[model samples]
Target: MLTLSRRFAAVAFSALALVACGAAGDGAGTSGANPSEANADGELGHVLGQADAPLTIIEYASPTCPACKYFHDTVKPTIEEKYISTGKVKFVFREYPLNEIDVAAYAMARCAGDDKFFDVLDDLFENQEGIRYAAQNGVVKTTLGAIGQRHGIADTATFEACLSNSEIRQALADTYATSEKWGVEGTPTFIIDGVKHNFQGEYTTAEGFSKQIDAKLAELGAQ
Candidate 1:
């Protein structure tokens, strides 16, 4: 049984290489791996977004990340409404679990399945502080199970099973590996095409984040 501290340590170590790359300014770029292969699985492939969209923005986040929750719940909806829905751009979400706490959260999110991913995402964000305390106190199962029950998951057994799943942990590790390759340092980091944009100050409001996105998009040639 990996304790919360142990899990978070492993997760942090796994991302060290990425954090270094970010410090070195190695930066991230579009995969350029061909949109066809990317869209083959309906956007769960290498890149996450509409295959044909002119602008693609991928948000790398951890469910337990406060900043990430703020960005997703506050900043993201506006971006999605104004850009993603209109098809001017595509928004892709990638997991960049920052700690053991985040690992559990990520597991829960994945367990929710793709169709329910966003729903679970919102739920977790809503209770992020309580969940963090629960994780620290080794009450992850209780905290997360309660969340599952609220979403009508019913079977606490299945949900707990996901927490202990080796395959799921390995998959999470792989996601961190990919983040390392992309030079990700922290959560709420946005990558447009190949360029990385670090948010300035507290961008907790939709208007603030939207302004940055609009500026970046225009710089990328929205004209």
Candidate 2:
């Protein structure tokens, strides 16, 4: 059976402690593409693929995580083509911001609304290298503004407003809280059929992921 590692357990505890103490800042304002359908609580996570697929995969990933960028740029397309588009699997992407900047990124993506959330997210991941450089150079806002413009955001003001939206901040915080409850300590954590799977220095490739996913599908008689 899959289990949470001791290190991850400690990390989860620390994250919960931070939430309990309210250390996670509330940043402010909001905007995006037309609002997409949301969960019962109005969280704007984007789900791709068939809703009733026998296999369900939810990924908790940080925008700034290099591993996540790699997964999105490489493995994700394959998964989409093979399983998601084929109606064999349902995939959900959840934001688990690791820092203030990551929270800002999530806010921007969420504000893009459900219709454009995944597109914005894809742009963010594709340009992660440039974004990291901009962040390091203290020009993250300017860089993000340009990115938003490319993705149909109205203007810099709108982009900034979205980044500062309090509601979006709360939604991101709630996502983190849920991740903690699930013992998710790191980015790109995959929850397959309610079982948590950490990267563990392997399974970073499409083939690797498929091996596990296929086994699960076979076990569930969904293949």
Candidate 3:
């Protein structure tokens, strides 16, 4: 059971997940700062694995996207195990939230900082259904506060404060501007070496992702 604070963080993170998809990816680069830095200030959009690795894979996703979670929980981990974990590749997660609710989720996650960003991310994806139910029934905000508490953000006041900040909203907008630059029209799109590949659903599987990765690696000739 996530405390309110954790839920808040999860929701914020989830919003960022969607925003990640919308963040800049055009050849002209992104706004504010490059997402590669540690203190990206939620401006990193979404990212994964190592940063300096040879191969860089950027994924644009939404929190409410079931397929996004499937890729995160199943497909992504497999890629991490075989490629990212070994330093053969690095991955970036970007937000591309489709609506206002999704935007709210990203705000909550930003409250927790980048350190807890991905951890809370996994939890949100794993419990997406439960969160949606709570939101639909009007208990979503409370549940999110509980989530914050579990994450050591026991200060409800602080959590709420973060959620309502104007800065977060600006960051969200920047994320969208960035996404549009990247030309994202859907979730789970992959950008490998700046070339975008939109998966037609099947890439959510481990084997399917692996095969595509292999193709990319082969194209690069492993060096």
Candidate 4:
């Protein structure tokens, strides 16, 4: 049920996702922004959990990725409650925007700042139905802007400003560099304690994810 413009956008996203496979992984050009890249201060990406948590889960996700929306809607609550809230797992979220609209979403998320990143993400995932509808009608940006205002971004001018914010742009580029290092080619790719886990049929449920995480924790003697 995509409108013409939305169909075009979807095609572009798929193309960019394919291109990211090649564009993101050129070694020296990546500039040391892989997952392991961090400062003495702390982890660089949006994060939640105790710093010394037994296990770390790094996720590269797209705002417009349906599978990602599914994960957020269903599986994430369990993982967060059981692992993250319990101080057993640390979660890091990075953007892997696949198109211009996806980039706009990421920019607004960044503009919301580190403190509100997860909140903004929560709202986005919770409202994906509306987002998808808006996308089909060629008003995705307007829809996202409405979402942004609810998060204090306020007004069309500032919302547009978020799209071109240089700092946010750089952070996103760094994620592509990180994806290059890790060979991530899809959404909801989870790196659990350095192991890359894909989000698909087997990983659409919390039980499946917990099985892998529990095993990893035991193996690391952190269980």
lDDT-best of 2 and 4: 4
Which predicted model would earn the best TM-score? 4
Query: How many clashes (backbone N, Cα, C below 3 Å) per candidate?
Result: 2, 6, 49, 0
C-alpha lDDT of candidate 3 relative to the true structure: 0.63
lDDT of 3 by residue, 1-223 (tens): 1223234334433433322333323332222223343233333565556666767777777776765776787678788889988877877776677555556566677777778777667766777777777766667766666666666566878777767789877776776666554556767677666656664434657897788778777877863
C-alpha-based local distance difference test score of model 2: 0.68
For the record, the alpha-carbon RMSD of candidate 3 to the native fold, in angstroms, is: 7.7
RMSD of each: 5.8, 11.4, 7.7, 6.2
Off by over 4 Å in 3: 1-43
**Ten-residue region with minimum lDDT total, candidate 2:** 28-37
lDDT of each: 0.62, 0.68, 0.63, 0.72
Candidate 4 C-alpha lDDT tens digits along 51-156: 8897888888877666777788778899999999999998888888766667788789889877888888888877766876887778887889999998999998
Candidate 4: stretches off by over 4 Å = 1-5, 8-42
Score candidate 3 by TM-score against the native: 0.75
Runs with alpha carbons beyond 4 Å of true place in candidate 2: 1-44
Lowest summed lDDT across 10 adjacent residues in model 4 is found at 15-24
- Prediction 1 TM-score vs. true: 0.73
Q: Quick one: ranking by lDDT, best first?
A: 4, 2, 3, 1
